[model samples]
Target: MGQDVYEELEREIALFLRRARAISKDFARAVHPELEADAYGLLIRIADDGGARGTDLADYYGIGKPTVSRQVRLLEELGLVERRPDPSDARAAFFCLTSEGEQRMERMRTARRERFQQMLREWDSGDAEQLARLLARLNVLFKTPLVDGP
Candidate 1:
C-alpha cells in the first residue's frame, strides 16, 4: 500500500473509534431505562453462545473478572441471568439467559440491525457483506489504541 493509503487507514480507524464510542454512549444512555450496557452485553453473550461464565464474559468484554462478577451478580438479581454449577468444573459457575433475557436480547438485536442497516444504506449489499466479513475476520488481530476511546 502507498503511504497515503496507510495514513488514510489510520485516520479512518481513529475516526471510527471516535464515532463508535459516541454512538455506544448515546445508545446506552437512551436505552438504559430498561437495562444498562453490562446487562445488555451479558444478554447478548448468552443469546450468542447459549451461555457463558463470568471469566468468559470478562475476556469477551476486555474487562476485569471482578467487573464481570459484579455485573453477573446484578443480572442474577434482575432475574435476567441464572448461574449453575459448571458440570465440567464443579467449583466454577456458568450463566444462561432466562426467558426474560432472551426476549430482551431479541429486542436488542432488532434495534441494532435496524440502526446498522440505516447507517449502511449507501453501501451496496455485496460490499457491505464483504466489509462485515472482513471486519469480523480482522477483529482478533486488531486492538483499539489505548488513547482512542473513553
Candidate 2:
C-alpha cells in the first residue's frame, strides 16, 4: 500500500533472483562439469514441455533465435538433447532430452526439491503453500502491464 512497502518487496525480489542464479550455477555443474549455467534452464524447459522447437524456446524466453540455437548445439554435443524432425514442418525440428539428459535432469530436480524442503523445514506446510500461490500469482503478473500507482 505504501511506497516503502514496494521498495522492500523490490529489494527482496532482487536478492532472491541473485541467490537463484548462484544456485542455478551449482545445479548446472552438478549435471555436468562442462555445462553452462544458462543452459540448465533450457534443459528443464525441454523436459517439462516434452519437446519444443528452437523458435518456440526463443519466443518463450524472449531471447534471440541465435542464442537458443547455440545453447541447443551445446546440449546436442553433450548428448543431453536431441533434435527430431517436426512432422508438420520440413524446415523445423523439435528438441527433446535424450535418455541420458532425462536421467540427469530428473536426479537434479529431485535433489533440488529435497534441498528446498530442508531449507523450509521450519515453516508449516500451509505457509509453504501460501508462498507457492503468491509466487505463481507474481509470475503471472510479470506478463502483464502493471496498474499505475494512485
Candidate 3:
C-alpha cells in the first residue's frame, strides 16, 4: 500500500479504538453501576473461559499480577465473580462468573449483536458477511507479527 493508504488506515484505526473505548465504558455501566470500564474485558474473559486462574488472566492480558488481583478483588466485591478451588491443585483457585454476572453478560452480548444487525440492516447479507470476515481477518493480522511490512 502507498503511504497515503497507510496513513488513512492509521486514522481509521485510531478512531475505531476511541469509539470502542467509549462503548466499553457505556457497556460497563450498563452491566452494573459500579463496574469499572477497564474491568469489562476481565468479566468477558472469565465469562468466555468458564473459569481462569489469576495468573493465567494476567499472562493472557499482558497485565501485572497486582493489577489483575485488584480487578479480581473489585469484581468479587461487586458479586460478579467468585473463586473455586482447582480440583487437582489445592493451592490454585479459578475465578468464574456468578449467576448474576453470567445473566448480565449474556444480555449485554445479545443487545450488542442486535444493535449490529440493525446497523447493517441496509446492507446486503453478502456484504455484511464479507465485512465480518474482513474484520476477523484484520484482528488475526494484528495478533500475528507482520512478515513483510515496515
Candidate 4:
C-alpha cells in the first residue's frame, strides 16, 4: 500500500538474486571446474530441451550468436556437449549433453534440490507451492517494460 512495501520488495529481490548467482557459480563449478555460470544455465536449457540449435539458444537468452558460439565451443572442448548436424538444416547443428555432462548435471541438480528441501523443511507444502507460483508470476512480469504502479 505504501512505498515502503515496494522498497522492501526491491531489497529482498536484490538479495535473493545476489545469493542465487553465488549458488549458481558453485553449481557450475561442481559440474565442471571450467564451467561458467552463464554456460551452466545454457547447459540446463539444452538438457531440458533434449537438444538445441545455436540460433535457438541465442534467441532464448536474448544474446548474440557469436556469444552463444563461444559458450558452445567451450562446452564442446570440455566434453560436456556435442554437436550433431541438423537433419533438416544443412548449415545448422543441434547441441546435446554428453553422457558425462548428463551425469554431472544430474548430481548437481540433486544436490540443489536437497538443499532447497532442507531450507524449506519447516514450511508447509502449501506455502512452498505459493512461493513458487508467486515467483513464476514475478518472472512473467519481468518480461515486459516496467511502469509506475497505481
Clashing pairs in 4: none
lDDT (0 to 1) per candidate: 0.77, 0.91, 0.88, 0.91
Q: Write the per-residue lDDT of candidate 1 for residues 1-150, one digit (tens) a residue.
A: 689998898899889989876776555444345456666666667779988988888888788998888878877777778999876797999999888767766776788889999999999999999998988976866655447667
lDDT score, residue 136, model 4? Answer: 90
lDDT per residue as tens, model 4, 1-150 = 999999999999999999999999998898999999989989999988888999999988778899999999999999999999876796899999999988887898799899999999999999999999999999888866576667
TM-score of every candidate relative to the true structure: 0.78, 0.92, 0.85, 0.90
Show the lowest summed lDDT stretch of 10 residues, model 2. 141-150
Per-residue lDDT tens digits for candidate 3, residues 1-150, read 689999998899989999999988888998999988878889889999898898889977768889998998888999899998976686988899999889999999998789788989999999999988999899877765556677
Per-residue lDDT for 147 in model 3? 62
What are the RMSD figures for all models against the true structure?
Answer: 3.6, 3.1, 3.2, 3.1
Model 2: residue 3 alpha-carbon error in angstroms: 0.4
The top-ranked prediction according to TM-score is 2
